[model samples]
Structures are given as C-alpha cells and as structure tokens.
Target: GERAASAAARAEAAAATADARARGDAEVLARLKVSEAEAELRGARERLAELAGVEMQRQALATELSGLKAGQEERDRAHAAELARLGETFSGLAGKALEAAQAKLAENAEAVLARHREAAGQNLEANRNSLAELIAPMRETLVKYETRLGEVEQARSEAYGGLKEQLAAVASGQRLVSEEAAKLVSALRSSGKTSGSWGEQQLRNTLEMAGLREGMDFTLQAHQAGEAGGRRPDAIINLPGGRQLIVDSKCSLNDYLAAVEAPGEAERLAALKRHAAAVRGHARGLAEKAYWNEFGAAADFVVMFIPGENFLSAAMEHDLALLAWAFDQRILLAGPINLLALAKTVALVWRQEKLADEAREIGKLGADLHAAIATMADHLGGVGRNLGQAVGSYNEFVGSLERNVLPKARRFTEMGVERGKKAVAALPAVDAAVRPVAARELLAPPADDAAA
Candidate 1:
C-alpha cells in the first residue's frame, strides 16, 4: 500500500508538469498569431494609402482633361466668330463699292451728255461753213466759164454744152451720194441682222481709217472653240507683242429706233429706258462669255461697238449708270468716235514698235561698220610701215654706190684705162618717205598695255 501511494503521488506530479508545459506552448503560439495579425493590419493600411494616391492621380487627370476640352471649345467659338466677321466685312465692302459707282455715274451723266451734244453742234456748223466756202469757189468758176462762152458763142458752142453737162452730172452724183447715206441709215433701223451688219461694216471702216489691215492687223468673225460650244467675236484686233483685243458689234438698235419714232414725249422716254435696259442686258451677256479667259493674251475688257453715237447717247440719257455698269462687267461701250480713237492709238503703238525694230537693226549695222573700219585702218598702218622700210633701204643703197662704186669708176677714168667720151651717169637717192596712217584707232594704245 505504501509503495502504491508513492507511485501515485509521483504520477500526479508528472501529470501537473505536463499540463503546465502544454499551457506555456499554447501562450507562445497565441503570441505568434497576434504578431501575424498586427503585420496583416499594417499591410492593409499601406494598401489603402496607395489606393488613395491612385484616386488623387485619377482626379487630377480628369481635371486636366476637362480643362483641355473647355479650351478647345473656346478656340472653336473664336474661330467661327472670326470667320463670320470676315464674311460680313467682305459683303459690306462690295456693297459700298457698288453704291459709290452708281452715285458717280448719276452725277456725271447729264453734264457729259450735254457737252457731247454741244460738240456735235459745233462740228455740224463747221462742216456747213466749209461746204459754203467750197461752193463759193465753184460758183465763181462757173460764172467765168459762162462769160467766156458768151464771148465766143458760135465757135465754142459744143464745148460749152459739154461743160454744162459735166456740171449737171456732178450735181446729180452729189445728190445720189446723199440719198444713199439716208438709205443706209434707214436700213440700220430695219432689222437686227441688218443692224448688226451695219455695225460691223462701220467697225471695218473705222479700222481702215486707222490704217489697220484686215488679215494682218485684225480678223473679222473669228471663231473660237470653248467648253460650252464656240464663240464668234465680230473682230479680233492684233496688238503688238502677239496680244489680242476682241470687239463685238451685236448691240441691238431696235429700242433706240422705236424711241426716235415714238409720237409722244412719254412714249419716247419709256422707249429710251427700255433701250438702256437692253444695253445693260447685252453687257451682262458679254461678261458671262469671259472672252479674256478663253484667249491666252487678250485684253481684260471686250469692246461693245455701237454703230451710232445717237444710240449710245440716248441710252445714257435714260440710264446714267450705263457706262459704269458696262465697265463693271468688263465690257467697254464704244461708239463710232470712241472706237476710232482706240484704233488710232493701237496703230500708233504698232508704228512705235516698228520704229524700235528699225533702231535695233541700225545699231547692229553701226557696230559691224565700226569693226570693218578698224580692220582697214590696221591694214593701212602695216602698208605704211613697209613703205618706210623700203625708203630707208633705198637711201642705204644710194650711199653705198656713191662711196664704194662711183669713186673707183672715177679713178679708172682719171687713169685713162680706156678712152671713152660718154660720162658715168650718177644715180639719185630717194628722199621721199611713206605717209603715216593718221587714224586714231591705229595709233591708240593696245587693249592690254603689258601685251604691247
């Protein structure tokens, strides 16, 4: 029993010790797990801090993107406003130009037309005065002839009759010429085709008067192909340096003729207004053709030829802006007088060009002639030097003969080697020298002094 109690006590002690060791091991493991949890919490806090920094960066990027988008929108608005302002400014300028042109035309129309009419009246008066002067001389001559015929009536009766017939025929011819002119004026007012032909004929006459040839200086009814179809200009005048000037003679005269024939003043005024409108219409049509674009070197403006000055004057009287409008359209409204002046100017330009060509040719010939003269002078100088050398040689030969040969011959004569009555003839030395060349070109210093 005692042994049993002792073993039991020992076993109890062992159990208690084992239990304490297990408790210590469990505390150590709990401490280790607590350390691990604390480290995990620290890691979680660091990850949260990183996420906050990313959120801040994302917000900054969004703010920057929004600012860029707003700036872009502002710039687009400014660009659009600028474009609108420029368009408005352009429109205003165009309107102002047109208004100014119209105003200027209105102010000048009446004064210009009045001046033209007054000039026409003066020209008519001058022509009449000239005609009267011519007729007065003819009248005096006829009177003298009449007196002479009466004095020798029987002998010169047939001659007097012939003279009378000749005078009558001349008067008849003058009347015929006047009638033909009237007929031509009437025909011009008859139809469009006739009127166009008349205008072209007048243009031809004006060109001839200006001394422009048909084929050489100008062409009639020239046909040019175009994208639309083809264009036929009435006349294409050749300018200097291969430039061209187009002239159209298709201006209508029907409205102007109607105005002239109108019975009442109101009707005449209405017809004149219509005439002006027709002219404007024609100018617009010509502008659309863009003849300058078709020709490589054509004048910017096309000439619109009106056969009659009256027609143009009447149109301008109603519509003061007719000329200004035509100018805007790049169409020049030229009456007979205006066209003649233009033609004359062109002819003068051609003459000036011809004179320039002739001057160039003359200058070239002068240069060539100068070179030839220089060559001749050089040759003449050479000939002079040769002549001088020959003269010097002749003098030396004469001296040698007098000193050596003549003295020996005279000594032989003195010795009486042979008795001869004929004396030895003395030869004369040449004293003349060749004349030097006097030309300045030959005597001048060499082009390169070192070479000389």
Candidate 2:
C-alpha cells in the first residue's frame, strides 16, 4: 500500500510539471541565442531524463508490490492445504487408536470369561469330590446300624425262647431236685464236719471262679465278737477305699428239697413258703449282727450268698418279697449270677484305679521329659558352636593340605614315592554312617538306673 501511494504522488508531480513546461516552452524556444538555445535544450533533456527515471521507479514499485501479493496468496493456500492434511492424518490416527483399544478390550473380556468358566468347572468338581468323601463315612455308619438292628432282633427271639424254657423247667422241678436233694442231705446229716467244711469249700470255689484271690480279696471265717465270734462268716470281701463287703453262706436247701419233693400240691406250696421264710430269717440274723461295726471299715450291708441257684430260685418264686425284705435289713441276696457280676465290677474298679495311677505317673514323666528336652537343647547349642569351630579347623587343615602339603608331596612323587589313587580321591569327603541311631537305644533304661 505505501509503494502504490508513493507511485501516485510521483505521477501527479510529473503531470503538473509537464503542463507548466508545455505552456512556457514556445516563448523560451523563440527568444533563445544559439548558445542559450543549446543550454535550454540540454535543460529540457535533463527534465525528460528525470521524468523517465521517476516513471521507471514507479514501475519497479508496482512490480515488487504485485510479486509480494502473489507470494502472500501462495503462502496462504499452502498453509490451508497443510492444515487440511494434518487434520486428515490426526483423524486416521484417532480412528486406528479407537479400533485397537476396542480389540484389546474384547480380547481381555474373552480371556476373563474363559478363566472364570474353567474355575467354575474346577470348583464344581472339587465340590462333588468333597461331598463324596463326606458321605462315605455316613453311609458306612448307616450300614453298621442296620446290621446291629438285625442282630438285636435275633437276640430278642433267643431271649424269648430262653424265658419259655425257664418257665417250663420251674413247672417240672421234682425230677431235677430229687437227686440233688438226696446227695446234699446225706452229706449234711452224716457229719457236721462234712457239712460245715464242704459248705465253706463250695463258697470258696464260687469266689475263686469269679476271679477272687484268697487272701488279697477276701478273708476266711472272719470271727466277730459275741456268739457270732465262734460262728464265722464265709468271707470278708475287700472293696476299694479300705472298705469291706461281707459275704455269709446260708444253705436252706433242705427245705427247698422238701418243697420240691412234697407229695401234694398244697404241701409243695406250704414247703416253698417255709423255705422263703427260712431264707429271710437267715438274712435278718446276719443283719442284726451289724457286721459293719465289727469290721470297722465295712459297708452298712452284708451279702447273703446261697451256694445253690436252684434253692434260691425256688424261694424267690414262692415269696417275691423275700429279696426285698432281706435288702431292707441291710442284707444283699446273691446267687452265683449276682456274685459273678459283683466280682467283674470290682475288677473294673481296680483297672480304673490303675489307669488313674498311670496317668499321674505319665504327667510326672512328661514334666521330666520337658526338663530333659530343655537341658538337651542347651547342650545341643554348645555342641553346635563346637562343631562350627571344628568345621572351621577342618577346612583350614584341608586348605593347608591342598596348598602346602600336596605340593610337597608332589616333589616326593618326583623322587619315586607314590600315593594311592583311592586315598587321594577319598580325602575330600566325610563318612555317611553318622546319621541315625536305633529307637531301642533312645528308650533304653539308663545303665546306672538298671543296675540300681
């Protein structure tokens, strides 16, 4: 814009100068001498030359301005094209990034889904295996219960049969009692010695069969004060806690035999009643003695034992209250069956007592073992430190042998002295026999204790 304005101002000035020169040119031309005319022409030529120079300057300015405008237009077009290309490039890059992101997200989703499905399958299998393991024991237990139910049913049938047989035997007692009655009666009547001795012998036999020791578990004919002193009890059975359970043998088999061999039904019933009364009378006599006071540490009851089960059974059948009446008098009635059960219970008590004592001993042993372990651990720590020192010394010795001794030995070999190949190879390793010892040795009684 400044160049155009300067060109316009130069044209206006040239036109004004041309107009004044045209108006004054004829006057100046007519009045001039040759010399003056020549000078005037030179002046006119100079003005013309100045005008041409001005016009050339105006043209140069116009050309430069036009070139600048064209260059500006070309640059604007190029910048727009470059911006459009950049936009297209950016759009392509964004589209590719979005596609890649979507593909990666899809792959991750598939991998996660696959992993979860596999894990679910594994969990289902594990659950099935666990359920199977859990159910196996329960199934076995159910089978065992079912088998036991069958056994119980069988036992019930056998018990009912046994009950029927017992009832039948009771109904037909004469044949069974006649022979046993004769032998026992003849034995008692012939001699009182045979009677007392054999009766006591019979009692002892039953006790022994029930696992009683003679002196350890019972005493023979333990005499008390008064008339009962001369009359001895069969045994004083020892119980736990320093207490005694007294047993007295009473045989009313004669009355029972009489009842069995009675001629008529009424006589048999009367005899049975007498026999039951006699048994109760004996229990009453034993209780009146109050043997618990005599033994000092005895229980408040006595055991009335009948050597014959048949005699006792007959009496019990005649009078159901006989046993109850005896018990009320601080007396316990016992046949062979009851005595055996009592003995077994006593044996069980002894076993439990032994177990309790062993438990106490084990507790003491455990405390001692703990103390021993603590001492052993202290000893082991000392041993470990000593072993570390020994190992360090061994390593030093080996290093000396390798660095110093073997080199000297090599020189000896040059002098024709030889070393065995096996010995040389064996020097680097230790023996393998030092690992373990026998449990017998570990648990063996100490030599000093054994000797003592």
Candidate 3:
C-alpha cells in the first residue's frame, strides 16, 4: 500500500506540475491579450482626441476669417472715401498749377515784348543820330554857300557910281570870298565840318580863353615848309621866350569815317589797316622833319598830336604794331589828355625859365655883395689905424701940457697976482710955438702922426 501511495504521489506531483505549466501559459496568453486590448483602446482614444482637435481648429479658423472679412470691408469703405477726397484735392492743385503757369507765361511774354520794344527804340535812335551826323556837314556847307552868294548879290545890287563905294563893295566881296575859301580849305583838310581842324581850333580857343595873345608874346601858324626836301609839320608855335614847338596834327578823318561806315567785316578791316598806315606814315614824316628844331632846335622831339581821342584809341586798338613803329622813330603821340598835359608842361617850363633868370640875377647880386664886403674890409682897416693914432696923440698932448706948463702955472699962482700977470705975459711965445706945432701935427696923415 505504501508503494501504491508513492506512485500516486509522483503522478499527482507530475500532473500538478503540468497543470502549473498550463496555468503559466494561459496567464501569459491572457497578459498578451490584455496588452493588445490596452494598445487598441489607446489608439482609438488617440484617434478620437485627434478628431476633436481638428474640429476645434476648423472652428477657430472660421472665426478668424469672419473677423478678417469685417475688417477688410471697413478698410475698403475708408479707402474709397480717401481716394475720392484725394482726387478732388489733386484736381484743385492741378488747376492752381495751370493758372500759375499761365500767369508766369503771360508775364514773361510781356517782359520779352518790352525788351524788344526798348531794343528797337535804341536801334532807331542810333540810326537817326548816325544819319543826322552824316547830313550835318552838307547842310552847313549849303548854308555857308548860300550866305556867301546872298552877300555877293547884295554887294552887286548896292554898288554906287562913286569910286570909293564901288571899291569898298569890291573889297568886301573879295574879303567874303577869301574867308569862305579859307573855310572850305579847312573843311577839306579836316575832312569834317568843324570851323577849323579840331586840333587847331581847340588849341586856339584854349589859348585865347586863357588870355593868351599872339604876336605880343608868341605866333601860331599852320604852314608847310621845305621846298621839296624836308617834311612840313602841321603847326609852328613860337613862344615869347624865343622858344618854338612843332605840333603836327595827325588825324585821318577819311580812314576813320570809312571804317565807321563800312558795312562788312572785310571792308572795315581794310579801312582800319588804311587808317593805321596813314597814321604811321604821318608819324614817320613828323620824325623826319624833326620839327622840334624850329626854335633853335631846343626841344627834344616832334609831338604827334592827335585831334581826337577816338582816333588815337581806334588806331591803337586796331594795330599796336603802329605804336611800336611810332616809338622807334622818336615820334611822340598825344591824345586830348596828353595835349592838356603838354600845355601844362609848357606853362611849368615857362615858370622854370623865370626861376632860372632869377637865379642868374641872384648870382650877380652875390658877386656884387662880395666886392662890397672886400672894399668895406679895406676901409675898416684904415679907420682902425687912424683911431689908434688919434688915441696916442691925445695922450701925448696931455703929457706935454702937464710937464711943460703946470710947474710954471703953479709958481705964478704962489707969487700972487703980480707974478701971475708976469708969467701970463711970458706965455705968448710958448703959445705961438706950441700952436704952430699942433697945427702941423693935425695936417699930417695918421701914419705920419704915429711916426712923429
């Protein structure tokens, strides 16, 4: 029975072990199923949560879109109103800009018209002046001729049978004719309508107005010298102090007028060159003349005096080469200012000459003074010697009186009136001899007196 019990126990233990093994396998399978169910549940929950989150996001986006649409509508309305206002403002600004532009254009147009009118008026005035200047000479010449003709007609009509009256009328006509001819010659030489050539007239007028008289102190003339060899200067002015100056009026009115009237560049240039050449030729002629030699040849050089400043300026402007040429030949050119300066220089020279004369007189006076001083010195030496001799004779006379007469006079006085009378009676002989000696001493020279 115990053996049977052991077998049973062993079987029971084996079955229990197999049952435990089956229970373990079933537990593992159950745990695996639970884990798989837990996994599926967690996945389903996660899907459900994802759906909820997606629905929430969609709703939030719809809310945001609704807000954005409302804001966009408001912005559209504000932008439309602002755009309308901006259009109106821009239209007003454009209108103002157009008005301002039109006003400025009108103002500029008026200014341009005014400038054009002013320029035209100035041009017209210039043309008129030029024309008048051209016509003036002809008009003057015509008037002069008419006057002369009228005077001649009058003389012929008024002539009488008397010889004196007829001769007088003839002389008058001749004088008129000569005067007119001289005027014509002047006009021709100057190529202008001036009474005298401008320079000559100005010089004459200035001198006259300054109280200068010709022939009393000086002589002025326009003369041509040199038979056929030397040059003839324009004017020879002789001064009071035996001084002479040559003033050559070098002005080419023809060339200057031609240049002024030339309408084209080529003509103007040619005229200018001609003027320069004429001026240079005149300058050379003046240099050759050495006209300064007229007054003892005292002056240094010839003065090339231009009548008009314009002529000198134009010549210099056109060609400075002529200036160099003039200088090379010892020709001195002078314009109006230079002419005035020269006159003043001449005045100063006159004053200087006077001063020189005074200086010479002073020199003579100094020599005379020196001679007088020498003579006075000789006279003073003689006087001093005489004075010394006089002083010596006076002292000697006092000594002689004291020594020869005092003791006798004293003895006579001591003897009383009778003896004194007797002494006085004896004094006549002594007085006679001493008076003669004193007279002889007075008749001699001081030098003789000193010797005695």
On lDDT, the leading prediction is 1
Question: Clashes in model 3: which pairs?
Answer: none
lDDT of 1 by residue, 1-452 (tens): 54355445545544554564477654433333333333333433444554456556556655665665566557556755664575466657676664565456445644554565566556556655655655564456456445533533443454367778999999999999999977866787666788788778999999899889999999999989988788888999999999999999855877787887899999989999999899888888888999998887889999998877988888888899999989988999999899999999999999999999999999999999999998988788788889889989888988998899888987887997884788767778788866665765677676797376
Runs of candidate 3 with Cα error greater than 4 angstroms are: 1-196, 205-219, 222-245, 261-270, 287-300, 409-452
Question: What shift in Å separates residue 233 of candidate 3 from its native position after superposition?
Answer: 4.1
Off by over 4 Å in 2: 1-181, 189-193, 223-231, 385-452
- The local lDDT score (0 to 100) that residue 169 gets in candidate 3 is 92
TM-score of each: 0.54, 0.44, 0.42
How far residue 206's Cα lies from its native spot in candidate 1, in Å, is 1.2
Q: Please write out the lDDT profile of model 2 over residues 1-452, one tens digit for every residue.
A: 54354445545544544564477643332322222323333443444554556556556655665565566557556755665575577767776775565566557655765665566566556655555565555456456545644544554456477778988998678667987877768887566566667667877887788777889888888787754455467888888788888888887555677776799999999988998888888888888878877777888888888877787888899889888888888899988778777876876776787798899999999999989976876676577667767777777888888899888877877899876675555366332232232554344478998999
Error of 1 at 417 (Å): 8.8
What lDDT does candidate 2 reach at residue 82?
A: 64
| Candidate 2 lDDT (Cα, 0 to 1) | 0.69
- Cα lDDT tens digits for candidate 3, 1-452: 54355445545544554564477654343333333334333433444554456556556655665565566557556755665565577767786775565567557755765665576566556655655654565456455545644644544344333667778999999999999877755575565446236666765554444444555423456444454545445455554367666666655667777887899989988998888777888888778766555435435666687777888888888878877778778777877677667666666666677799999999999999979976876676677677667766777776777789887877766878354233343322222112222433224368966698
What are the Cα lDDT values of the candidates?
0.75, 0.69, 0.62
Model 1 clashing residue pairs (backbone): none
